[model samples]
Target: MALNRYYYPTKYESRAKVISLGVKCVFISHQQNDKDAARKIADYLINAGVDVYFDEYDGDLRISHQSNNARAVTDSIRKGINNSSHMLVLVSPNTLRSTWVPFEIGYGYDKTDLSVLCLKGIPKGSLPEYIRTANIIRDIYDFNIKISNVLEKSQSLLEETKLMSSYANSANPLSNVMDAMINDPYN
Candidate 1:
C-alpha cells in the first residue's frame, strides 16, 4: 500500500518542531446512523490527546434551497481530510448502507497517507468489500494501540532526523581539524 512509503519530513517542513508540538489530528468518517459509536470513538481519541474532526461536531447540519449546503459540507469534509494526518473510518453494519462512507474512504485514501478502517460491532468475516483492503483495527484496544504507535513512530523519526542533522553540522569541523595534518604532510 502507498502508506508504506509515508514520510513525516516530506509532509511537514519542521519535522522536529512538529513532533515536539505533540498535536496530531484525525478525521473520522462514519454514517449518521452510527453517531453514538462515532462519538464514543471521538471522545476516546480526544481523551488520549488527539484532535478529532468529526462531521457531526464540525459540520453544518442546516439545509437551504438557496444555498449549496451539500457542496459546503463536501468542501468542509475535504478540507478536514486534507488537514488531518490520518483518516479513520468507523465501520459498522450500517456503514454498508451508507453512500457517503465510500466516497469518504476513497477521498481519504487518495488524499491522506494513513486511512484506517475501524470495525465496530461487526464480524470479521462479514467485512464490506471496500473495508477488506484497508488497515483495520478490530477493537478499541487495537485502535488505541494503532494511534499511539503512529504518534510514537512519528516522534521517533523526528528525533532521529534531528540527531542526524546535528551530527552532520558539527562533525565537519572536527573532521576538518583531524584532516589538517594529512593535507599538510610536511608538518
Candidate 2:
C-alpha cells in the first residue's frame, strides 16, 4: 500500500513548537502473522519522521541468536516499551488469539509513559479486553491522525514540563519566603 507522508502547518507557532521537539519513538505490538501490516504502519510513521520500534524489523536476528526463552523476550519487550514514548498495538483477527500482545499492552500501561493506541486490522466489533481502554484507530487515516495527535500532545507536555522546571529554578526568594510562612505552624 502507498502511504503518503503527513504534513502539519509549519508556519503556525504551535505547530512550529511541536516540530522543534525531538522525534517521538513508538513501539509497535503485533502478532507474527501481521508483520506486513506492522511494516506498513512502521513505514508510514518513519516517512512522517517518527521513530518506530518493531521487533520483527529489529529483533528477529537477536532472537534467533538467543535461546528464545520467554523471559528473554519479555525483557526485551519491556525495554522497548520503556524506551518508547508511545505504543501502537495492531489488532488483527489473528492478533486477538496471540498471547504476547496483551502482555505487551499491560506492560506498556503499567511500566512506562507510553500512550497506548489500538489499530484495527480487521472489521470486528469485539476487541481484546486489554485494548478496550486504549485509543482505537480504525483505518490508515485514523492511524495518521492518532500518531500525529500523540506526538503533538507529547511535545506539548514536554514543553510545559521544561517551562515549569525553569520557573521552579528561577531565583524567587520572596515566593520561597511566602511558601515558608504559609506552611509554618509556629508563626
Candidate 3:
C-alpha cells in the first residue's frame, strides 16, 4: 500500500544541532500488549546512549500499571511521537489490526522518516493492508542489525552535519552580526 511521506528537511538552512547528538528516538507501538518488548528495546537503546521515548512511562504516576493509565499515556505518546526525530515500530500479527499502531505509524509517516522493525514475519497473500510499504526485517536479530545500520548512517550524517554547521556558522556573515551585537565595540 501507499503511505504518506513525512516532512524531511529539504535543505539545511540553519543547523540541526540536536540531530547530530546521535539518534533521539521514539518507539511507537501498541503499549498494552507490547510492554515487555518495548521496555527491552528502550533499555537497549538507552544503554546505547540513544534517547528513547516510550509510552509506558508517560501516564499517571499514581497509576502503577500502564493499563490503568490510558488517557494520560495516549497524550504523552502523541507528544513523544511528535517530538522525536525517528520512530522505531514493532510490527507483529496483532499489530495489523491494532488501530493505535497504524495511527502511530502514520503519525511518524507525517512527521519524519521512520525505521520499522517487524518482530514477526510478514503476512502472506497481500500485506497487512494498513501500513505503508515498509522495509521489513524478519526478527529482532535482523532488527538489531538494521538498527546498527541505521545508527551508523545517522552517526555519519550527524558528523557531516556538524562539520557543515560549523563551517556555515563561521562562514556566514550573520555570524558576525550576532557576534558583533554581543561584543559591541561601541560599548
Candidate 4:
C-alpha cells in the first residue's frame, strides 16, 4: 500500500545510445538452489545498463523461516514489486514449486511489468498460472529480448529505440500519435 518511488523509465532514440533512467528492478527466484542463477541474471541486466534491486544483491530483505515467513516474504516481495517498475522471475522446477514466487507474481499482477526467464532445465509446463502468461525465454540472451519488451511497455519511453523502432514508425500513426499524446507527451 506504500507508494513506489524507485521505478524509472529509460528513453532511447534509434541512433542514440540508450539512456537509462536507472530503474530499480527486483529479482525473484528460489532462495536455496536458484540464488546463484538469480545473481547471474541480475548481473546480466546490470551489464546491459539496467539497475537491479535483487534481494540477494541488495540486502537480506526477504524473510526466512518455515511457515511464519510467508507473510514476511510476501510483504518483502510486494514491497519490491511496488517499488520497482519491472520484475525478473527466474523459472525452474524449484521455482514452479515455490509458493512465495506465486505470491510475488500475484502481488505484481497488473501492477508492474514482469519478465520470466526459464533456466535450461525448467519446463514451460511447470510454470505457475501467473508466470505462464509471461513471454518465456529459454536462456539469458532470450531473456534480454523479453526484458527489453517488458521495459518498453512499462516505460513507454523505448518505443523509439532500435529494439522497437518500427513501432514508432508503424503505419498506424494515429495510434502512435494518440499514445504520444496520452502516454508520452515528450516522445
Candidate 5:
C-alpha cells in the first residue's frame, strides 16, 4: 500500500489528523438519526482523553461515503474500525432500523472492545438481541466507571465533568439529554 494520489482518500488521509497514542481509540457506532446522542458520547470520550473516530466530525468520511459507492463506504468504515481499539455502540430505538450499525458491530466484533450504551425512552426488551451479550453501559454512572477502568486518572476527570452537569445554566459536559440513568429498555 503506497501513498499515491490515484487512490481515493479516506477520512484519516484527508483530515491529516494523526493519533500517535497507540492505546484506546474508540470507533463510535450509531445510526444517523441518533447523531446528537452519539456526539455527546464522543465528547465525553474526548474529554476523557480517548481518541475517537466519530464520523460526524470528519468531513472526509461524510464526503467520501455519500456518493453511493459501496466500496467507499465500506472501506471508510473498515479503516475507522481497524484504527480503533474499542467500539461503543450508542444503542437507541433508532438503531433497530439502521443497516450500517449491524454491519459495524459485526465487522468489529472480534477486533474491538465493544460496549452498548443505552439511550433514554427505551424499554427493557426493546434492544436488538445481537448486542445484548456485549458489556452494557447502563447509565452515566456505568459510563464513568467503565472509562475510569479503561484509563488511569479518568475517575477524577469524570467526577469533575459530572459536577459540571449539576450547574443549571451550564450544559452537561457528559450529556445534556439524559440524567444519571438513560432510557434503558433492557435492565
Candidate 6:
C-alpha cells in the first residue's frame, strides 16, 4: 500500500509538465500454467489504461527460461520489478508449485505496492504464510475495488467499460481456473 510515487517536472517540458514515475504500472507475477488467466487480467487492466508488465509478452524472459538460463531470467524479472510501481501476485493451485513466484514476491515485497490476488475458491486460510499477510484481492469485485483505489478511478468508470457485466454471475476473467479449483487450495 505504501508505494513510492514520485512526480518530477519534465526537463524538456513544453511548459513545466510533470511526469510520473511508473505511476500505474503493475508487474503481474503468475505461474507458467496460468499465463492465459494472467493475460486476461492484464487485458482488463490495459483496457482501464494501466501499464502492465506481464511476462507472457517478454521475449527475453521467454528465451531465457526456455534455455534454462536462470541468471538471465532473474535479471529480466528484476528489471520488470524495477520498472513497476505495483506487483500483483496471482494465486491459484498452480501457484503453490511455482519456483519463480516466491522469488518474485520476495524481491518485489519492499520495492512495490504488493497485493496477493487469489483466484476464486482460494480460501484466506489456504494462502501461503508470506502471502497471507499482504493485502488480498479475493474476487473480481474486490480486485476492481483495490485496483480502482490505486488508480484513483471511480466505479462508474469501470461500469462504463462494460466489463463488469461480463464478470457478473461468475463470468470473471479467470472463471475457468476458478471453476477448476478444488475445495482444497493447497493441493
Lowest lDDT 10-mer window, candidate 4?
A: 178-187
Candidate 6 matches the true fold with a TM-score of 0.79
TM-score of 5: 0.77
Superposition error at 69 for model 5 (Å): 0.9
Summarize candidate 5's per-residue lDDT along 1-187 as a digit string, tens digits. Answer: 1111112243343222424433466789999999988877777776666667888866556777677777778887888877677788988878989989999999989878899887865556777889988998766766777777766555666567552233232455555544466444355
lDDT of 1: 0.55
Stretches of candidate 6 off by over 4 Å are: 1-22, 161-187
* Backbone clash tally (model 1): 0
- For each candidate, give its TM-score against the true structure: 0.63, 0.61, 0.56, 0.59, 0.77, 0.79
lDDT of 6 by residue, 1-187 (tens): 2221111121222111212432566889999888888878777776656667788767788899999999999988887777677899999889999999999999989878899887756765778888876787776666777667767877667667654323454555656544323333332
Q: What ranges in model 2 sit over 4 Å off? A: 1-23, 64-66, 111-121, 153-187
**Model 5 RMSD, rounded to 1 decimal:** 6.6
| Ranking of candidates on TM-score, top first | 6, 5, 1, 2, 4, 3
lDDT of each: 0.55, 0.53, 0.48, 0.50, 0.70, 0.71
Report each candidate's C-alpha RMSD, comma-separated, in the order given. 18.7, 18.1, 18.3, 13.5, 6.6, 7.0
Q: What digit string (tens of lDDT, one per residue) describes model 4 on residues 108-129?
A: 6665567676665553356667
By lDDT, who's the top model here? 6
lDDT of 3 by residue, 58-105 (tens): 534225343666676455456566556677777555665666777777
1-187 in candidate 1: lDDT tens per residue? Answer: 1111112223333424434665366778888887876766665555445666676644243232126676776665666665566778877678889877788888878555454444433554676766667776654334544656655644334335431112133332222211211111111
